[model samples]
Target: MREALIVWGGWPGHEPEQCAAIVAGMLRDEGFQVHLDNSTRAFASPQLSTMSLVVPIFTMSKIEKDEVSNLSKAVREGTGLAGFHGGMGDAFRDAVEYQFMCGGQWVAHPGNIIDYRVTVTRPDDPVMQGIGDFDYHSEQYYMHVDPSNEVLATTTFSGEHAPWIKGVVMPVVWKRRHGQGRVFYSSLGHVAKEFDVPQMRTILRRGMVWAARE
Candidate 1:
């Protein structure tokens, strides 16, 4: 079976395990051998080299140096790395190296987490294909994104109360090429129920498929 590993922990508000399970099912449906571990300890093993993809469902927290290195190296060698919202971008907040690999960090969620719309930029992309436009009544994230990314979709800060240091247009779905590996991220997923949305499910699944080391 094709292998994919999901590492989940940190904030419980995001329902780490549930969200991981949702993604796990998506991966499994796409013919992957999925493993779900709600811990940061898995990063201690070089066993990661055997997996085709590594997904971090973690929130704002610090991770060990060796764990970070293991994950970073795995992705560099062409293994997939993908996640959404704080689970991916906001993970390992205190580590500079982790942030560097993640490509962006969640700075804030302005307007107290309201509904917003995300527009697909690269419609021809495999991950973004068929996902024209959709609205998410969830936390609209304001992030500090990396310039070296192929932004797939962006959402504007339509909420009036947002403290956006950046511009109105912010990216929600993006992909980056780091070394030989493909890194994909989305700034949605604040709620575990996000997985229940058909469009969101399709988008997340497509990303996983694109990121997998096929």
Candidate 2:
């Protein structure tokens, strides 16, 4: 069976454990042998290289150098990396290498917890297949994303919160390649319950599976 490791821990505000549980259940249903933990030590395990996917649910936390190296190497060697919201995007802010692997970093969320629309930019992509534009009420993430990302969905700023970025179109969901590994991310879930949204949940599920090694 393909293996997946979900390491979650950081700001309690993001409900890392709860979010991890939800995703873990989904991964299990998808036929992956999932391992769940709340420490970054899992990143350094010899088995990381053998795993199919790594989901880091840490937010605004510090990761050791060795842990980063191990994780980066595994992903580069074909282990997939996938995550959502601040868990992956805002994690390890000081670790530039980790951010490079992720292809984006959470810079801000204007109007913290507000209503917004997520527009599907790539309807034909398998990860977004069957999904349409949806409405959501949460932190509309204003991220600093890598230009190389293959953006699949986007959200337009209304300028209600940040005037300077009024017409900014930010990527809400994206997939990219880091070495031979597949990297997928979405800035949709601010908390566990946000995944309750059918479209949000479905997109994440498909994205995770798509990121995993074949």
Best by lDDT: 2
Identify the candidate with maximal TM-score. 2
Clash list (residue pairs), candidate 2: none
Give the lowest summed-lDDT range of ten residues in model 1.
Answer: 158-167
Instruction: Tell me the spans in candidate 1 whose CA falls farther than 4 Å from its real position.
Output: 163-167
Model 2 bad stretches (over 4 Å): none
lDDT (Cα atoms) of all candidates against the true structure = 0.84, 0.95
Tens-place lDDT per residue, model 1, 101-186, is 87899988877668788898999988877778988888888889899878989988754774434348888898887778888898
Clashes of 1: 0
Task: Quote the lDDT for 203 in model 2.
Answer: 92
| TM-score of structure candidate 2 | 0.99
TM-scores vs. true structure, each candidate: 0.95, 0.99
